[model samples]
Target: MSLELDINAAIKAAMLGKKEAELRALRAIKAAILLAKTAEGGNGELTEADESKLLQKLAKQRKDSLEIFRQQNREDLAVKEEEELAIIEQFLPQQMSEAELRTALTGIIAEVGASSPADMGKVMGVATKQLAGKTDGKAISAMVKELLK
Candidate 1:
């Protein structure tokens, strides 16, 4: 199923199950889809790439909120953010392990012919395209930088 259709089904299932966090996440996903649709010059329907990007953004937002809440000693809020993150993550593809990511990055570095830190940009460009929806860009960038140096 398309990500949007899957999300709608999940929302229905969450409602029937009385899963509050999942319900909230479902609504957030719907809102993001609508926003993407209505954004100036945006296509009415999101491409798969667009949906993946949106989901990634949502995950990042939840993670950032969780960290901020923890920093402020708001355990309750942090817990809520963590719950939402879990729900959101259910829709994302399985993430790469650190070792897997390192292996992939090494291959990408070689493919891009990156020889030094000066070639970081070339390595990152190829890695991001290959690893999108599988790994976090920031993490990939850090790994590439470390390997290049």
Candidate 2:
């Protein structure tokens, strides 16, 4: 099913079950969808790639907030962000483990002829496109740097 449809169904289920945390996450997703549809250059709809990017962005935002809340010793707020992040993650593609990511990046570096750190830009361009839904940019960058060193 499409991301929008899946989110709407989840929203309905959350509402029926009176799941406040789940409902909050679902509503946030719905809002993000609407905003994406209306954004400049958006044709009032989202492609699969766009949907995946949106979900990743939301998950990352929640994670960042969770970190900040935890750092400030705000367990209550951190718990809420953690719940939302988990919910958002459920809709994302499975993240690659460190071993898997490293192996894949090795292949990518070779394919791109990235022999040194100077080739990071070239390698990152291809790696980000290939690894999009499977991993985030930070992990990709870190792995690429380590491999190139």
Candidate 3:
């Protein structure tokens, strides 16, 4: 519940500071968490992995919206999505740099003996597990394809 505590603290601070944009993002996060907690089959306590996955999902949603908004010339909407994304990503682990991702994926490839695109599944399964919360899946996929080729 540390995430919840931190979020609540942030909500209070945001309320004090009267930052409307940030307050909106923080409330959205709190709502998502509460909904997750009460959803059917929810176990009430989310593990660190669960928290990371949830944050990643939220970030992904914002990114996708941001991309679409940009494409459609909806800068008005894109700005809000970008702001929300920034706030959501703040709670996630630091992303691996491209160089760092390459190094890590290279090591995983060797460990799994994945030498061709055919072995992408094997490498991805391991990489996704090992690199959870550190990087997005699409980035990992692109790098894996590059390294394999």
Best by TM-score: 3
Decide which is better by lDDT, 2 or 3.
2
What is the lDDT of every predicted structure here?
A: 0.90, 0.94, 0.92
TM-score of model 1 vs. true structure: 0.91
Q: Quick one: ranking by TM-score, best first?
A: 3, 2, 1
Ranking by lDDT: 2, 3, 1
Can you tell me which runs of candidate 1 are displaced by over 4 Å? Answer: none
In model 3, the worst 10-residue window by lDDT is 43-52
| Off by more than 4 A, model 3 | none
TM-score of each: 0.91, 0.95, 0.95
For model 3, residues 15-133, the per-residue Cα lDDT tens digits are: 99997878888898888889888889998877777878888999999999999999999999999999999999888878999999999999999999999999999999999999999
How far does residue 143 in candidate 2 sit from its true spot (Å)?
A: 0.7
| Count of backbone clashes, every candidate in sequence | 0, 0, 0
Window of ten residues with lowest summed lDDT in model 1: 43-52
Q: What is the lDDT for 96 in model 2?
A: 95
Alpha carbon deviation, residue 123, candidate 3 (Å): 0.7
